[model samples]
Target: MKNIIYFFAAALSMLTVKAQDFQGVATYESKTSMEDMKKFSGNNKEITPEMQKMIEERLKPMFEKTFTLTFDRTASTYEEEEKLGAPGDQMAQGFKMMGSLFGGGGKHYKNVKAKTMLQEKDIFGKEFLVSDSLPSIKWVMGSESKKIGNYTCYKATAVVPVDKSNMMNYRPKKGAEEELKKKSEDEMKKTNFMDMVEMPTERTITAWYTPEIPVNQGPANYWGLPGLILEVSDDKTVLLCSKVVLNPKEKSEIKAPKKGEKVTQAEFAEIMAKKMQEMQEMGGGPGSGRRRFGG
Candidate 1:
């Protein structure tokens, strides 16, 4: 066993040195748990058990997705696989709206060497090109090991700040209702968008990477590993690589997105926040002092 491990480690080092000659494609299936969704809907009196089940069934496709990652040595592009669905479908529209908040509906390109990232997003009818530096994640390697396909994978973990608007991180606060009840009407009306629902301030991420592949790339917003990441899990969602094709005959061009109005990551985030505020003001979102939407 020690010899096998050493062999793979040495092979990984060699591949790392010759990474420029490498190219690959990985297919990942991402699924978010519906536990929070069920709890959130349970709070609504108007939504019966049947209605909740129907909603869950309809929204399953949105929460469960497949993405393709194309990568070489220093850069990678990750995007969702297109699926056929009915036009003007309510669930599709819901997915589009939620996608903007969750940073979906985009082609994400990351350049590891340059420490840069470019993402193309379409919100409503407008398109945006989000340009930014790659986020640095501090991963603590673990001794745990497992097999994903024929490759041996090792575990690594990191703690990352949560996106407050992302529903996946949401949980019901123990005393959120009582706390709100104690506040004056004016205070309630002035509640910030994030105050109505509770979510963690940070989340721990677990990733499994295979040294045999020898690439510092992962599915989405995850990298800087010693090898190619095959699986990643954040409390609510899991992204697992289902298929890998290395050095395929046809390699797609890896390039940064060029379309859409250029904006920094911060600028795009501000735009989303403002849009959420607008929705809340119209009583369509949380913090409206009447309706509270949760994950």
Candidate 2:
């Protein structure tokens, strides 16, 4: 009888120790300017009521886009992450078309993976392979804390810098290919836009993270903070944590996408060209007839 009691106590203690220590959801919102649409219509006019309605329908709230990030950090090392559940591919294609029509330069959709060694000299020169490297990023600690579902959350801010070196490679149509080629050569000669261009554009990203989670990682390449980011926001949109399931009944694995071969930014441009050509062929031409419009 004593042995059975000891076994039950040990089992209970093990369950308590193995319980999920960190689990939460993070939200992010981002917006784009609507003024560029005028150029597509070939008229620099104020948005009309009818056009506004159409735009609203196409770009409903969060249509500009929002990201929901869920993290499960029950283990010593974080794991089991999921990204945006929306139709990202279709939306990316739409943005690419819009950019091309407005001379926005380059592809609107880009995916890059790079290894970065974080050397602050304070953390013993620990290095991690960060996902993407964008210029003009600022990490701001916020003075707010709140409970997001079951986990307590804190806030932080980051600014994403715009660098020409980070500009994506988007290929133009056959008719516009010559122009793009010239522009590309010119870009090569000039200083990178990040170095010279001074646009009034700024992306202020506010994130809500939790110290209770004790893991320094977040969705979409943002990490290395004191806690996991549970929410993120920009000037245009807001994402909030909705649901969090910490330790599931079984172990989970977290992995990155492995659809395309790894390539440099230049090689990615070539791939974009081939992809654009395929799309053009499917559509029958550059100014193809409009398809059914529904978000």
Model 1: lDDT equals 0.78
Q: Candidate 1 regions off by >4 Å?
A: 1-20, 176-195, 286-295
RMSD in angstroms, all models? 5.3, 13.9
Pull out the clashing pairs in model 2: 26-230, 136-161
- Overlapping backbone residue pairs in candidate 2 total 2
Give the Å shift of residue 292 in candidate 1: 24
Which candidate leads the pack in lDDT? 1
In the range 98-183, model 1's lDDT, one tens digit per residue, is 66556476799999999899888766657789888888999999999998987789999999877553556667677755565566
Model 1: ten consecutive residues of lowest lDDT? 286-295
Tens-digit lDDT string for candidate 2 (1-295): 9668746655653454345553344444434444323222222134566876666556443235444444444212222222343576565455434332222221122122223211000001111122233232458888888877766678888876422222221212234323323444445344222222122334567888866555555544456556666666654344555554445454434334332334443343343344334435554332231342110
Q: Model 2's lDDT to the true fold? A: 0.42
lDDT values, one for every candidate:
0.78, 0.42
